[model samples]
Structures are given as structure tokens and as C-alpha cells.
Target: MGSNYHINNVNGPAIFGDNGRMEINNGTDAATLLRLADQLVERMRVESPALVPQAQVIQGELAQDGRPADRGRIRAALETIGIGVAAGSGGLALAQEIGRVLGL
Candidate 1:
């Protein structure tokens, strides 16, 4: 059987597979999250160009292939731009998905 883990401030819970592997639901896998991060960066480039650099750093980290990255920095950067990831929101879901992918 698999187990579910609910993280505070995140939109959805994550599942631990029978093989002890973690997976997020609804296609929120690593690649998808990375794509989402890229989209976010692009949107920021237009709407908030000043924050694009921070988003780029996140994109770089995501491109590092499961290497350890700074979740705090990512969160801080988003927060600095008033982007809070509330429950059930796409932002929260994406962040949670990224966290799972990065093994945070």
C-alpha cells in the first residue's frame, strides 16, 4: 500500500508509492513542474521583469537533474514578488510538485 503525505501550505498531498518512491498527483512530475517554472518565468518576464532573474535561478536549479537546490531561496524569491502559494492554487501545487521532484 502507498502512503500519503500532506504538507502544510501546499495545495495537494503527495503519495509514497509501494516502492517507497514519492509521486505527486495529476501529472505534477518533475518535467511538468520544470515546465511550469519556465512558464512562470516567462510570465514574469512580461508582467514583472524585475523578478525574472530570481525565476531564472529557479529554472537553473530545476535543470540540474535532481541535484540539491535551495527551496528556501525559491520560496523567498516568489514571496518577494507577492506570489504566495495558497492551498488549491496552481502556484502552491507547482511548488509542492517541485519540492517532491527535488526530494525536499
Candidate 2:
């Protein structure tokens, strides 16, 4: 899996994802997503700190998990961000692109 980041507009935080998708919209969900990412990283560190030392392997693992949890989070964040954006903004487009990447 590949990763990409985008901003819905000038006012928002940088949205992150693979294939330009995200699931963070309001401050609450955005915070949750950021928190989730942090938790996942922390969990990975505790469960397999060696991954930290192996960038390539870690990247691959993250990509693999994309199929289940990672991808779902990405989708949710994208929806949230899209809602935050103006109607007909790029958030949905980005989410759609991400879906394409996920082959959903």
C-alpha cells in the first residue's frame, strides 16, 4: 500500500492516507484518528519494537493491515474530513480515490 496526504482547504489540518483518503472530519473524530494512529504506533512499538528499526518492514506491515483496520480508519477519516469541507469539495473525491486504491 501507498500513503498520501492532502488538505481539504487552507484552514484544515493536513489530512493523511493512502491513495488520498481520510476519515477525520470534526475536531472530535480528527482527534480520535490522530489518537488511534498514535495508539497503533505505540502498540506496534510495544509489540514489535524491532519494526521501528526496520522502516521497510514496518511500512509493509502498515500497508498490509490496510486491508482491515487501516483501510477502515482511512475511510472513516476521509468521510469526516469530507464533511468538514465545503459541499462538493475534494474530500469525497479524495475518499473515492482512496477506495480505488483499496479496490473497494
Residue 57 alpha-carbon offset, candidate 1, angstroms: 1.8
Model 2 worst lDDT run, 10 consecutive residues:
51-60
Q: Model 1, residue 82: displacement in angstroms?
A: 2.2
User: What is the C-alpha lDDT profile of model 1 across 1-104, one tens digit per residue?
Assistant: 99767574333433654355555455456677679788767766666677678777778776786675566676665555446333465544554545556444
Error of 1 at 17 (Å): 15
Instruction: State candidate 2's TM-score.
Output: 0.29
What TM-score, computed on C-alpha atoms, does each candidate reach? 0.53, 0.29
Error of 1 at 81 (Å): 2.4
Cα lDDT computed for each candidate against the true fold? 0.61, 0.43
